[model samples]
Target: MRLHAASLYYFDAVRRAGSIRAAARRLNVASSAVNRQILKLEDEIGAVLFERVPGGVRLTAAGEALARHVVVVLQDFERARGEIEGLKGARIGHVDIVTIEGLTRTFLPEALGQLHDRAPRITVSATTQGSDRIAAMVTGGQADMGIGFDIQRQPDLRQAAVARFRLGLVAAPGHPLAGRPWVTLNDCIGHRLILPDASLSIHRILRPLLADLPPGEGAFVTSSSVQLMYRMTLAGLGISFQTRLGLEPELARGELVHVPLMRQGEPMWSELGIYVRAGRSLAPSVDLTLRLMADHLVAVAREG
Candidate 1:
């Protein structure tokens, strides 16, 4: 059955808001107009798309199936428009990215600076989120790409590139363990530790290592913010366990030192991945940003 763009857009809004009136408010249109388009779509498809409830409507199996196609169709249309603009010698387009909080402080800013130098017309909209939410943003079409550590495999997302970053102990220059090439969890437990909380991916990577330490010798301070953790480390409050990816500035300025977290005298590593929605073609601006980020991440990984 043929469907209009208006119908698909109205349907998508209803699915997201779960209430026709709510969707209408968001779309700045009348509720009856939104309902009429959805009804037309259902008639063309010959099936009830939503299960009307007292508070809101829920997508039926048919609606769920159609929603997936609608996302792809709308995204493809946007990509096509961007490509057409590129063909007309205009490099103007927007690239949206969702990344881990750490990158915003270090790698992302550098990468975006380079991107702007290369393509001044391209605009970037970036959001910092936890690693777990990065993949979901890409899959949902909210962001063109996601960058994070320890991202699990998702059916609707693909890993475009990856870097394995070594987890390490970071401290101020005068700290006792700062001179060490590597340190074990037991050795780290002897001092105050400023550690990432369960919300951060680094926390999960260090969980096994922490489990190996004496039961009561956990982190002295646990936080989800990378910047706060880094600041605490620089202030000589405690050593933090983290990757070198976002610590380049501090390391270069002699503000912080990174010693590899050792297990049997070898460094522990976590995988950092660049992700995009599976089976979707990227727009020109997104493709360029992905390449730039991949290059920077691979270089950082190699150095780590």
Candidate 2:
């Protein structure tokens, strides 16, 4: 069965927006036009793609199946266009990435900036998501790449590169724990603690460590935002625990101190990984970005 590009475009937009009117607004087309395209697609496929919900639409089983193929088809089309541009001596394309929130503060921006400086014609779009969602996006072909900690393992996703970082206590420069070589959970519980919320993989890793702490010894505040946790720590409200991946600026400026978390004098560590869909060939721009990211992660890992 063949579907027109416009029909597939409208179908994908409606799937994303959940409503024809909203998708029309996004596409800058009339709602009736979008609806006609969707109807035409359903007629060609001979399946009801969406179920009408009260305020929006939900995908049917057939819709779900088609959506997956649609994502791959659209991505392949974009890649082919990029290759054609390359053949014409123009190196231009877009790379879509989904990453964990922690990288936004420093790692991702720096890497993207470096890529832009070297390849001015290439553009990038990045969204911050939790590790699980990042993995799903990469596996489903919704994103070209994912960067996060402990990405969910899936048959269709491959870990392109990884770096291991020891989790550490972060505090303002003059905080009481600043000079410590390493600290145990028991030592940290005595002070106010800013903790990562369950959305972050770090929260899962640290859960067992905090589980044995005394009843009243718990987090002063919990949040999913790494930036918020860093700011609170800088304000001396509490100490926070995280990898050193995004802490370079603060550590370099002496704005914060990071002491490794320890158990029996051994540091606690977590793996940060880059993921891409398996059995797929990446576009040149996407491949370049991935290489740069892998190089950057390797540098950060060696800094430990």
Candidate 3:
């Protein structure tokens, strides 16, 4: 006998609720109505569906078997519903977003704000990790999309440039290097320096110059929070290196100054971009987020 979808739904609801009265409460129906459906389903299937107990109902062996199948059917139906609703332009869904800690504070919020305004029902769950971690999370399927500077393309992922940025030398106000027209990397060596970890592309490019600096002089090496590091520099911790976008507010406030460094001429400077898995299918909401991300990048570049 073919089981009805309503019968399966009511059966699962009763099993979860533990009693016909509770099931009725959950389904917004009368207790008698719930009992009638369960009884009708048992008669049609020719098996006892539940065992009566002192306080409530318990599923019989057959009922337990049917419950497992009912759950799968219900879950599959819900998945299909979500897929269809997405195509219908329903904004109700979730997107897992990963990005570097620095961009999350400055660039991402500006972009995400616009995304939420345009698609209020679509929710973005964002997590801030280091650049390498962000790349790993996206490639590993832990996140749907990512926003990072100097994105690395893994075999399983594809990257599209969303914006371009370059790492620059920044010093706190009243610091010795603040008024320089431009300084070579060697010139920066004498002063205390705060640097990004050598593992990142920016730092890797700066490594030769950084290594040439006088021994025991490079003061800081870390990743993933330029804002905090910049603050530390303002506190006179050291001269920090950061992306121009990250230093915008500080530069505007005159709390920090950008001192140009020798351009190595290699594309060590590259565009910040969006990355998605190459072969994996993306949800419509995620695709929309990527599109918005591109637009935001263009706007950011233009404004600068």
As a whole number from 0 to 100, the lDDT of residue 182 in candidate 2 is 87
lDDT of 1 by residue, 1-304 (tens): 2244698999988986889999999999999999999999999999999999999999999998998888788777767777888899877688889998888877899889889988899999899988877877788776889999998897989999998878888999999999987888888767998988877888888887778777678888998888888888889999998888778888999999999887886778888899999999888878888899899888777776
The list of candidate 2 runs beyond 4 A from truth reads 1-4
lDDT of 1: 0.86
Who is ahead in TM-score, 2 or 3?
2
Give the better candidate number (1 or 2) by lDDT: 2
Task: Give all candidates' CA lDDT scores.
Answer: 0.86, 0.88, 0.73
Put down candidate 2 lDDT per residue, 113-211, tens digits, no spaces: 889887889999898987758887887666899999977688999999998999999999888888988888888868999999888999988999899
TM-score of each: 0.83, 0.93, 0.68
User: What lDDT score goes with residue 285 in model 3?
Assistant: 70
Model 1, poorest ten-residue lDDT window?
A: 1-10
**RMSD (Cα, Å) of candidate 1?**
3.7
lDDT for 146 (candidate 1):
92
Give the per-residue lDDT of model 3 (tens digit) for 1-304: 2244577778878987789888999899888888988998999899999999988999999998887667556544544555778788686566778887677666888888988998888888888776667677675455778777776667877885576665567887788877877666766766776777744456656777777767777766465456567678888777876667766787789888876655554323546778876665565677678888888888888776
* Candidate 3 total steric clashes: 1
